[model samples]
Target chain A: MSDTKRPLSPHLQVYSWSLEMALSIFHRATGVALGGGALLITWWIIAIATGPDAYDQFRTVMSSITGKVFLFAFTFSLMLHMCNGIRHLFWDMGKGFDLGDSRRSSKMVLFFSVFLTALSWVIGYGMILEV
Target chain B: MSLRSPLGKVRGLGSAKNGTHHWWMQKVSAVALVPLTIWFVSSIVQMTRADYEVVINWMNSPIVAVLMLLFVTTGIYHLKLGLQVIIEDYIHSEGSKVFLQMLVTFSCVAVGTTAGFSILKIAL
Candidate 1:
C-alpha cells in the first residue's frame, strides 16, 4: 500500500458521543454479534443430530459458567439488535427521523432491550427451576 | 440557463435506482421477524427440558418447520444487506469492501442453506 494523502470523510471519532451516536454504533456491533450467534444455532442443530454423546457434551459446555456468560451477552446483543432493528424499520417508513423522535427512540431501544433481555432470562430461569 | 443536453438531466450520482429496494426489504424482513423470532424464542424456551425426540418432533411440525425456514432465510438476507451497508460506509478500500461484501453474502447463503436443509431433513 502506498502512503498517499487523500480526503477522508468524518467518522465517529470526530463527533462527541451521544446516546443516538452510541446506539447507532451499537446497532452495527450487535448485528455482527447476532450473526455469530446465528452460527451457534447451526452448531446446536449439528450437535443434536450427531447423537447423545455429542449432544450431552454440547449441553455440558453450554451450561458452564463461561458459556452462561456468553449466552447472556448473546441474549443482550440479540435484544439490542431487535429493538434497534425495529427503530430502523420505522425510519424506513419515513417516520421517527426528527430530532425529538430520534432521541426518544434511541432511549426506547436501550430501555426495551434491557427489559426484554431480563424478562427472557427470568422466564427461562423460571422454566429451568420448574423442571 | 444554457441549452442543456438530455444526458445532463439524467446524470446525477445517487443510488441509481437501487436505494429504496434494500431499505424496503430490510424493513419487510424486520416486520416479518417480529412474530417469527417471538415464536422461535418461546419454542426454544419451552424445549429446554425436551429430549432429542421431543425436539425433533417439534421441529418436524409443518408450521414450526415453515416458520423456522422463513426466519432463517429472511434473517440472513437482512443481515447481508445490513452488513453490506456497514462495510461500504466504514471500509475505505473499495477492493476490500467488495471482497467483504462477497464474503458476507457467501457465508449467509451457506449458513442459511445448511440450516434450511437440516430443518427439511428433520421435518421429512
Candidate 2:
C-alpha cells in the first residue's frame, strides 16, 4: 500500500527543537530503556526463586558500583516515563491540548520526574546504609 | 467494475476491526501502572536493606504476591505494546518490522511467564 512514491512527511531535521518535542522523544527513549529494566527485574525475581545462594549472588552484583549506577538510571527513566505517561493520558482525554498548557505540562513532567527519582533514591540509600 | 459495497470493501481491513484495541490497551495498562508502579517502587525501596529471607517472606504474603503478579504481567504487556509501536514507527523495512515485532512479543510472554511463575512458587 505504501509502494507509491508519495511525498513523505517532514523529517526530524526539518523542525526546530522544542520542549514538547524533547519530551515526546524522551518518552519513547525512556520507554525502550525500561524494557531493558524489565529484564533486570525478571532476573531478580528468578534469582529469588532459585534460592538463597542465587539471591546472594544477584545481590552482590546489584550492590556493586556499576549496578548502583544502572539502578539509578533505571529509577530516573521510570519516573520520567511515568510522569510523561500521565501527560499522554490527559491528552487521551482531549484535555491539555493547548500549546501553552502542553509546554507548561512538559516542564512539570520533567520536574516531577527528577524530584521523584531523587526522593526514591534518598529513601533507598538511607535504608541501605542504615542496615 | 467493483460490485462490493463500500463498507464491505473496507470491512476486516485496517482499523476497521479491533483497530483501536492496541491503542486502547496501551492506555489501559498505563493507567493501571500508575498506581502499581508507585506501590512496587516504594515496596522495593523498603526492602533495599532486606536480606534474602526477609524478601522471600515478603513475597510470600498473599497481598504482596498478588500485586507482584499484576505488576509483572501488566508491565510486560505494556512493554510489548510500546516497543511494537516504536518498531512500527522507525523500522520501515517490512521484513525487519515483522521480525522485531515477533521477537518483542515472544520475549514479553517469556519474561512475563517466568516472573509470574517465580512469584507463585515463592508465594505458594
Candidate 3:
C-alpha cells in the first residue's frame, strides 16, 4: 500500500438531505446499531447461565441511568429498523413506488417509531400517565 | 452455469452463482425477524421490572427458549448479511473486505453458539 491519498468522490456538500435520504441512511445506520445490540443480548444470556450472582450484577449494570439511556436508544433503533423493513417489504411488492408515497411512508415510520418507543418505555416502567 | 464452457464447468466455478440465494435468504430472514423482534422486545420490556428469578423462569419455558434460540440465530444471520453488503460496497481494500467478512461470520457463529447454549442450559 502506497502512502498516497486519491481524490475523494463528491459527497458531503453535493447531496442535500431529504426524508427519503434520511430514512435510507437511518435504515442502514440502525441496522448497524442493532447488530451491536446483539452482543448485549448475548451478555444477558451468558449471565443467566453463570448463576444468580452474575445475573444480579448484570441487572445492576442494566438498571443504571446510562444503561437505561442506551437501552432506550437500542429500542428506538429496533423500532426504526422494523418500520423501515416493513416499508421495504411493501416496496418489494411494488407498492409505495412514487416519491410522494415513499415520503409519506417515511414520515409515518418516523412518527410511529417514536410513538412506539415511548409507549414501550411507559409500559416497561409501569407509568400509566405522566404529565 | 448455463451454456458455460467445458473448462469452466470443470473448474467448479464461474461468475457468481449464489447471488439469488443470498438475496432470497436475506429477505426471508428479514421477514422472520419481524415477528421475532416484536416478541423479543416485548419480553425484554417486561423483564425490565422483573427479578432475576422471574427472568430465568421465563427463559426456562420450552416455548420461550426455542423461540429465543430461533430469534437469535435468525437475527444474527440477518445482521451478518446486511453488514456484508455494506462492507462489500464501501470498503475499498480487498484485504479489509475479506478480513471484515471473516470477522463478521466468525462473530455470528460465536454469538449464536453461546447464546443458544445458554438458553438451552437454562431451559433444560
Candidate 4:
C-alpha cells in the first residue's frame, strides 16, 4: 500500500543507457578527477615560488610516464567538465528541454571535449618543439 | 502549542532565501573559466619547454599574473561548490557530508592562497 515498499524501478539491467546519462555520470566523475588536479597545480605553483631546483624536481615527475598519463587524463577531464557545464548553463536559460535537442547537445559536448583535448596537446607539443 | 501558520512552516523549511545564488554563481564561474582555461592550458604547456627564467618572465607579465589569479580563485570556489553538491547527494552519512564540506573548503583555501601568493611573488 506504500510507495516506499514498491520495488526500485529502472535498475541498471532494466534501463538502456543514453548519451545524456553517460555524460551526466562523466560530469561528476570529471569533477572528482579535477579535484586531484587542484592538488597537483598547487604543488606546481609552490615549486615555482621555491625556485629552479624545486621546479626541476617537479618537472621530473611530470615527464615520467605515469605523470604524463595523469596529466593527459586531467586535461581531458577539464575539457569534459567545461563542455558539460555549458550544457547545464543552456538548461538554466530554459532552452534545450526537448528530447531531441538534449540528445544532440550531449553528443556535441562529447565531440567538442575530445576535439579540444587533442588541439591542446597538439599545440602543447608545438611549444616544446620551439624550445 | 504551534503558533506558526501551516504556510509559514511549509515555506520556512524550504528556500533559504538565497534563491538561485549557488546555481547562478556556478554558471558565472563556468563562463569565466572558459577563456581562462584556454589561456592557462596553452601557457603552461608552452612553459614546459622554457627555462626557469622564461617561466618566471611569463608569469611576471601583468596580464598573465592577473588572469592566473582570477582563474585559480574562481576555479577553486567553483570546485568547492561542485564538490559540496556531490558529497551532499552521494554521501549518505550526515557526519561524512559535513566533514567533506570542511575538507573541500580547507584544501581549496590552501591551494588557492598558495598559488595566488606564488603568482604575486613572481609578478611583484
- Please report the candidate that would top lDDT against the real structure: 2
lDDT (10s digit) by residue, model 1, range B1-124: 5465656544532336454677678778889888887777777866655677787777778998898889888888878888888897889997898899889999999999998888887777
lDDT of 2 at B2: 70
Q: Rank the candidates by DockQ, best first.
A: 2, 3, 4, 1
Candidate 1 runs further than 4 Å off? A1-11, A127-131, B1-17
Q: Give a tens-digit lDDT track for model 2, residues B7-122.
A: 76667554446657889999999999999999999999888878999999999899999999999999999999999989988999999999999999999999999999999999
What is the DockQ of the complex in model 3? 0.70
Could you estimate the TM-score for every candidate? 0.84, 0.90, 0.88, 0.88
**Which 10-residue span in candidate 1 chain B carries the lowest summed lDDT?**
B10-19
Q: Candidate 4 residues B36-86, lDDT tens each?
A: 887888778766667778887777899988998998898899898899888
What lDDT tens digits, residue by residue, belong to model 4 across residues A83-129?
Answer: 99889988989999899999999989999999888877776755344
Quality of candidate 4's docking, in CAPRI categories?
medium
Listed in order, the DockQ scores are 0.44, 0.82, 0.70, 0.64
Question: After aligning candidate 3 to the native by TM-score, how far in Å is the CA of A78 from where it should be?
Answer: 0.3
TM-score for candidate 1, please give it: 0.84
Candidate 3 falls in which docking quality class?
medium
**Deviation of model 4 at A94, angstroms:** 1.4
Fraction of true A-B contacts recovered by candidate 3: 0.77
Question: Candidate 4: which pairs clash?
Answer: none
Write down the worst ten-residue block by lDDT for model 4 chain B: B10-19
Cα error, residue A40 of model 2, in Å, equals: 0.6
After superposing candidate 3 on the true structure, give the runs of residues whose Cα lies further than 4 Å from its correct spot.
A1-12, A127-131, B1-14
